[model samples]
Target: MKHLRFLNKYFYKYKWWIIPGIFFVVISNFFGVIPAQVIGHAFNLITENIQIYRLFNGFERATVIYDIFSYSLFYFGMLVLILYLLRGLFLFFMRQTIILMSRHIEFDMKNEIYAHYQKLSLGFYRRNNTGDLMNRATEDVNRVRMYVGPAIMYTINTAVLFILVIYAMFSVNVTLALWCLLPLPVLVLIIYFVNTLINQKSEQIQEQLSKLSSFVQERFSGIRVIKSYVREDYTKEIFAAESQGYKDNAMGLVKVQALFYPTMLLLVGLSTILTVYIGGIQVIDGAITPGNIAEFIVYVNQLTFPVTMLGWVTTLIQRASASQKRINEFLQLKPDITSKNTESARLKGNIKFEHVNFTYPDTGIQALRDVSFEIGQGQFIAIIGRTGSGKSTLANLIMRMYDIDSGNITVDGNPLKGLNLNNYRNQIGFVPQEVFLFSDTIKNNIAFGLDQVTDEEVSTAAKNAAVYHNIVDFEHKFETMLGERGITLSGGQKQRVSIARALIKEPALLVFDDCLSAVDTRTEEEILRNLSKIMKDKTSILIAHRISTIKNADKIIVLDQGKIIEQGNHEQLLQQNGAYAEMYQNQLLEEENQSL
Candidate 1:
């Protein structure tokens, strides 16, 4: 219930529906209970007229008595029928308001979770799995909806029906009504005990379901790897084991629920038997008439269904409580990364890192330490480093995916943190080492960053990235759809397509972080030539391992570990005989040897 308080705002938002829904519930039950009174009256009418029929038998006046009997029966019959019809109408209205409100709340909640998922920092994603995130938004939300809809509806329906029916019974004969309700308090106590077990088991089942979904998601995504390694059987065994655990937990709850229903049937049947026995005694004593006994029986039976629904409603509530707790866990989180400024700025791309320092939050590894660099507008700078030498970290910092621990990063002489995060990110074109593309057409993938783009612009960007020839060769050309992560394209083709995605933006600061590792050196050279012309007035930063790729950079920086070991133009680094010169000589010798 504490966790469920989070849903109060949604309830208030849809209050018109809820308010009217409750009204319909009360009205429906009010009409539903009146049928019992009508039945009692019809019984009394027949009982009272029996003497008149006996005295007027076999005579013409007896025809008048018969007409009276016929009209009385017809009147009572029609009244009961009309009452039931009215009850049915209000029942329909009750569902329309309450059930429909639940769907709207569900829509709002899913959108909320998805939007928050996007706003969270990278560390949050690293700490959570996709399946768990998806489960909380979908499955957990569904359970919560049940509580908002059917559970609440039934609970209120039962309560209203109980109240109307019980009051009618007591108004006629209090002592008989009291005896018939003996099992109700006992039913309440039993449901209280059963609800606890339901809550505990429900949480376990949801948790296991999340694990199962995650296992399936990962296995499907890596199915190619599994086939290549021939580990399909092993994965199947693990899946079977997980499925067994889920089934066992589900059966546990089902067993408890299974025992619950029969027990409810027995208790409800006891009330009916008590009404027949005790009311029979009352009628024999002349304390009430036989019609009164018949009415008592009807009242007990009317209360039957609501009493039976008690266990079910409580079970749903317990499960929903468990699920809402899970949902509230994620909803309560505040993202660590937020923009200090909200104003958009046109960037000139003069970026400076003043002794920047950063450590990965998930891991204690410091990716950058005391690193400093500057890139003026229209400068082409290249960072060369061994693997894990803080090159990618520099790119990440420039993109502001994570903030620095100490020191500051400035763009166009303004603090990076002082710019609107979304506005700042929208201006930069960043191509990471591991490229990701959507399962969409080639043209759409190229134009993904923009809301609207011309097909001609897409083609021009592809031509600049050196992937236009490959695309044209396809039967569908730009309209050809890609598989997940662009798996349909070859490695180099995928890299080039990724480059086109960034190139189409024509951004102020364009970064290529080892994004050209798949293409041949000839293609790389051709693309680099195109970049020189297109990015003449923009700030460009290229992080690569190949010496040939960065040799023509305006300024070259070489990194080892987390520090810059050498900095200068190609000639200056070669003359110094430092790490860069060694890498250049080794590459040159390797190329010469390969020619042999």
Candidate 2:
């Protein structure tokens, strides 16, 4: 239960309901004892040939035996009715309280977990499986909910039933009651073994289930590639293997569960037989009244039933423990980045990189080594590099996705580490290579960062990105639902929308990391032309694969193996006849051949 301590704060909030819930359980327990005593008394009246009317207190002697029998039946019926009513009250309050508690915990846990994910450094996400993380937050939280709700209710039921039934039995006949309890130690030992087995099996079952879920999510998200290569059968085979593994593990769990119930029933039955056998001889010897034997039987059933359920409760608790372990592991991970900005500072457009060095979190290989650069306000700079040549790393450094190992990055000479990240990011706009658009109207996607923007402003940004006409062609125009990931839009259209989103921010600095790679040359040129028009007085960093995309930039930086090898305008680099010259010559030759 210590694993659940993190939830205590939420649980404590509803103390009012919990307190009443406990009271109801106590009242229910007291009422539950009544039925057993009445049943025992009725049995004694029937067996000892006593007047049943007199056997029930407050009932006068009756001439007709039918009247006496009816009175006895009435007494028994009332006892059962009251007990059942209290039981219902108990269940209702218990269910309501547990559900409220679980709901509170689940809601807060998800919020905290997601907030933590948002604060984590990009390197952390790069090393972890996103699908599994989602499982931990959603499915794993649900598992915790189950434990808090049903598991708690059953635990309380078992404990209350055990104590009350034991007291009732001892009050009626201590000797037979002790005889009935003789199998308890053996039953406990069996339960311990069962709990251990169940825990082990449940862990395996959950692991396989997670693997299956991750496999399914990955394949479904990449279904286009699977269909493109006509590898449907191969994909199916792989999915079948994963699915069969989950099935086998689940079946094993069923087998364990199958044995759990019957074994519990057998032990309870054995305890019952022992009580009846020992109590009968005492009755025949006239050592105890027959009513005592009947009450003893009722008490015995109450005791055995709860003890049997104890086994089932133990199983659920073990499974819950397994779930808690997974959830706790995720919660315990310390984020690589910290938001310790006790004093907020506004950002300036001037950016600087001073001998910055960085390495991938998982691999020690340096991604950026002693690289230094500076960009003042209103400069249009382009970064060109071969694959894995640290172009993206430089952009990431500015975003503070990964902290530098040495030196510093600053905005207007203010160290990034000292400034509030949220405040700093608000002054910059970032557009990534892979465009992500939510399922919403085009207007909403464009104005996502800003709370409110005029319709004129939205149209202006879309027009500048060269996507305004395309949006207007839609039947709903700005109101059209984009569908998931903007699936309803074309790839080039998605790229343009993303560009428009960045443009609308109207930030002091805009970073486009290969944002226009999808569009045709003409569209790309037009978008860039529009960007220059709007961002004439803002710092801009453009990363691109095509030389033509950045030919007219104020300056270009060529990176190779985490170091800048050249920096100049396209004309100067062309005349220098170095790495940049070679790249340009290759592009020029390819275009010339295409024209031919």
Candidate 3:
């Protein structure tokens, strides 16, 4: 119940619909209870006429029969029909308003979750599994809708029906009503005890389902690896184990329901038996007529269904509560990275990293230590480093992916924190080491960064990246559709397409983070030559492992073990004969040996 408090705002927003919905439900139940009294009166008319017929001759007996048919039969039939018609009408409106409101609320909640996901930082996604997040977005949202729809409606239905049925029974005979309701307190005790167990089992079931979804997602995404490793049987066994756990948890919930429903029915049966016995004795003692006893039995029967439904409604509430708690956990998260300042300024790419130090969260390992560098506008700078030398970390900081532990980064003399984040990012075009292309047409992929782009712009960017020739050779050319992550394309083609995506943006700052690794040396050189013309007035940062890639740059920086060891032009570094010279010599020797 505490977990449901978050939904209060939605209820208030739709209060007009909800209020009328509740009124219709009450009216339907009011009409539903009247049928019992009408049927009881019909029985009384038949019983009295039969007695009168027995005391009369044939003509008089025929007249009593005719009277019964004319008065009791027609009146009772018409009243029952009218009551049922009104009940149906109200029930229709109840569903139209309340159930429709629930669907709208579901739509709004899902969008809210999606918007929150967009605001979350990259680090949060790295820590969470894709399948788990998806389950919280989809399945958990649906369960909350059940709470707003059927659970609420049925709860009101049960309450209104109970009150009206009890009032009707008390009107007939008070003592018999009290006796028939003896099982209610016991029913309440059962619900209280069983509800606790249901809540626990329901939570366990949802947790297991999330685990199963994650397991399946991982297996499908890595199916190629499993086949190459010849671990099909091993992976299958693991999946079976996860599936079995999910089944066991589901069965546990089913077991609780199995016990709960029967116990409810048993209580209802006890109340019915009590009504029949007590009302029969009262009629036999001449304290009440047969019609009174009949009506009492009808009222007790009406009470039976609502009482029986109590167990089911309790289960729904418990399950919905468990799901709400899971969903609220995600909604409550505050993003680690956000733009605190609203000031906007255009960047000229005069970037400076001042004594920057950063340690990744939860690992305590310093990814960058006192790293400092400066890049002026329209400079061609290259960074060469061994693996884990914080090359990518440097680029990530520039993109504001993570905040530095200590020190400041500035763009165009303005502090990075003071400038608006989106405006700052829009000025830079970045191609990461790992290229990710969406499942869309090649034209769309090239123009992904801009909201409005022409086909001519896409074509020019592709040609500049040295991929247009290959694309034109295909049957569909620019309209060719790509698979997930561009799986259908070669690695080199994907890298070129990624480069084209960034090029089309025409950003003030361009970064290529080992983006040309898959392309051959000749193709890489051709692409870089084409970029030189376009990058004449734009600042460019190129991160590469091969010495040949960066040897022609205006300036090169060499890093090892998260610290800068050397900085010079291509010829100056060779003259110094230091770490950069050693890497250049090693690469030359490897190339000479491969030629042999």
Candidate 4:
């Protein structure tokens, strides 16, 4: 119920449709209940006339009874036909308006979740699993749609029909009506008790489903590792365990429902029996006519179905409530990163990091500590470091992937925080260590960032990255569709394609975070030579572990333990005989040994 309040805006948005849909529901119930009264009246009219006919002559009585019977049947049949027809029409409109509106709201909700995900920072993704997020966006959203659609429709139908039928019963005989409603308070109490259990069970079922989804998603993504390790049977066992957990939770919910629905029906049955007893006594005393008993029975039957349906409606509400709580938790999250100032400006190549320090969230390990550096416009700078030396973290900061703990990063003398995030990011080209390509055409993958790009531009970028020959050798050239995560390409080929993706942007600042790790030294050199020509008038930051890769840069910075240890060219570092020189000698020896 609390979760439903989050949807008030959507209800308001579609009120034009929803309000009319509710009207149709009410009118449909009116038609549906009216038939019971008609049947009762037809019986009453026949019974009353039969008593009258007994007093007349044989021929007169026979003709009068026949005429009354025929007219009564004809009138009852016509009323039923008209009422049912109207009921069907309104039911159709109700579904068209309300049910369809729920579908539209579901679409809007999914898109909104995706849009919010885009705004969230990298830290959020690190904390949440892909499958769990996907479940919230898909399965949880569907459950909420049920709440807005069938659940709401049935609830309104049951409520309105209950009111009408109770009014009808009261009109017939107040005492009989009160007797029939005696079990109602007990029924309400039962519903209230079962509701708590249903909500708890539903929440458990949804959580288990999320866990199962996450397990399956992780297994599929790491299938290669599972196969390589020959752990298929072991993985199957793990999956079975997860599946059984979900099944057990679902069964628990089913058991609660099994108890809930039957109890409601039993209570409704008791009410009917009570109605028959009280109404029979009234008829025997001649205080009310037989027609009153007949109408009361008809109205009681009408109430029975809806009262039973109340249990099902409650089930829908509880399930949807559980799912809505999950979705609301995500929707309410505010991203730590926000573009507060909208003053947009194009970036220049100069970048300065002043007293920057950052620690990874959740784990208080310092990834960077008072790190400071400056790159002049169009300067080619290189960063070399051991693993976990904060090299990649530095590049991430320049990209503003994470806000610094204490520092100011400026581009062209303007603070990074003050600039429009999108405008600032648009000017930078980044090729991360782990390259990711969409399941799209080679050309589309390379031109992914651009709104409109010419084929010639794509070809030129591919050629610059030294992947043009590989593309041409493929059956479809640039139009070749890649497999998931570019699995169709070799490691080096994927790296080169990623490089081409960034190169096509022709950004003012280009950061290659160990992007050439997969390519051989000879091929890496060739690519670097090509990049040097393109980056002559652009700022380039190359982060890598290989000394040979950054030996020829205008400036080289060596980091150790999140702090800069050495800063100089390759020859200058060798002259100093520091950590960089030691690493270079060690790598050179490893290459020589491998050759032997």
Best-fitting candidate, measured by TM-score? 4
Tens-digit per-residue lDDT, 351-371, candidate 4: 988989999885788998888
What tens digits encode model 3's per-residue C-alpha lDDT throughout 324-387?
Answer: 9998998999987789776667668888889888887756778888878888888888999899
Q: CA lDDT of each candidate?
A: 0.91, 0.81, 0.88, 0.89
TM-score of each: 0.96, 0.94, 0.96, 0.97
Off by over 4 Å in 3: none
**How many clashes would you count in candidate 1?**
0
How many angstroms is residue 347 displaced in model 4 relative to the true structure, after the best TM-score fit?
1.2
lDDT computed for candidate 1: 0.91
Model 1 residue 213 CA deviation (Å) reads 1.1
Which clashing pairs does model 2 show? 40-295, 44-291
Better of 2 and 4 by TM-score: 4
| Per-residue accuracy of model 1 over 112-212 as CA lDDT, tens digit each | 99999898888888888888899999999999999999999999999888888888888988889899999989888988889889999999999999999
**Which portions of model 1 miss their true places by more than 4 Å?**
47-67
Q: Candidates 3 and 4: which is better by TM-score?
A: 4
Model 4 gets an lDDT of 0.89
lDDT of 4 at 142: 95
Among all windows of 10 consecutive residues in model 1, the one with the lowest summed lDDT is 303-312
